[model samples]
Target: MHRARADCTANTSDPVDGQAMHRARADCTANTSDPVDGQAMHRARADCTANTSDPVDGQAMHRARADCTANTSDPVDGQAMHRARADCTANTSDPVDGQAMHRACADCTANTSDPVDGQAMHRARADCTANTSDPVDGHAMHRARADCTANTSDPVDGQAMHRACADCTANTSDPRIVQQCKEIVLLVLLTPVILWVVKPCTGLVLVVLLTPVILWVVKPCTGPVLIVLLTPGIPG
Candidate 1:
């Protein structure tokens, strides 16, 4: 009976040991599964972080591209504006130069009493002096008047008087003597026609009678008179 009791005790202890072993095995399996799950979570977190960072990097790149585009366009726009201004300045300068040239030419024309190729020079003078009674045009007229006044005391030849009258009529608008000057010009223009038509026999007789007296007075002065006659008359 003693031996049988001892054997039963031994059997109970063996079952207890087996239970402890089973418990230890279950704990090991749980521990292994925990590490695997932790590793998977770590991988998932890393993948999520990368995904989030990708959009931020893409946005940064987009902003950089926009900045570069704007920076590049600014200089181009500035250059275009500069070119436009330069073109406008050049266009404006040309007209001013042309105007100055015209005025200078007009002044030169008015100062010279000799019949300039007036027709050829008229366009330039007209353009410069057109509507505004510019001081420059007025000054030229004053100079012409002074020249005429200086020469007025010289001997009065009808032909010279006619020429002077014509010059004054064409160049001046002073009303004081304009009508008289015009009449003088008309008389001079008509004189040749009148002389040719009349051919007065009485006038011829008088001219024959005075011819010797006229010749004596004129002979000594002929050289100077011929020179004056040959020289082209100045406008003033």
Candidate 2:
């Protein structure tokens, strides 16, 4: 009779979900998407939130964030978002996590995943970027921002790269680099458009021909980096 009462209490509150949470846990362990496929994800989430007796660990929460990746249809975005939050919260960890997040997302896709999540990334960038008090990441940050703009076609990211690169340029404390970087980024974005308008060989030759003049104008502010950054455009 006592056991029956206990079972009734369990059913009244969580019912089968307390058991199903384990199923979701196993699903994560197996690296499968079953939880995402059904209510198991919801149950797992609710159980993780409410049940102190069976506390979920960081890895579990990490996988829980994978559900966000599934939503974006890109796994790395979710991981970067989760990791950036975890490492950058309270201004505690290194800025590399945040910077890496930006670069990693660029590799697959950028904030084009979701409008709401995109805002979160913006906030995440601000929070993470501010954590490091020094200007050490300036060069890397500049390159990363430029890379962010060059890699993705999203106009939002294009604007974001400008703003973020401005912050990065502050590391060098050179006012001229701002406009220089902007011009370089514009040239980067326009290269493909130019290629489409002309033959690949002609476009390649144009890039080769224009390279000296563009660098001469921008190199003082950009340092010697543009040569390496621009070289990958050559198909052969």
Worst 10 residues of 1 by lDDT: 46-55
- Give the TM-scores of the predictions, in the order they appear: 0.17, 0.23
Cα lDDT listed for each candidate: 0.24, 0.34
| lDDT of each residue in 86-186, candidate 2, tens digit only | 22222112233333233223222322221211222322222233211114433212122332333222221222122333344544333345556777767
Stretches of model 2 off by over 4 angstroms after superposition: 1-177, 221-225, 228-230
Q: How far is each candidate from the true structure, as Cα RMSD in Å?
A: 41.5, 17.6
Q: Among these predicted structures, which one has the highest lDDT? A: 2
Q: Cα lDDT of model 2 overall?
A: 0.34
Stretch of 10 with least lDDT, candidate 2: 49-58
lDDT by residue for model 1 over 16-63, one digit each (tens)? 222211111111111111121121111111111111101111111111
Q: Assess candidate 1 and give its lDDT.
A: 0.24
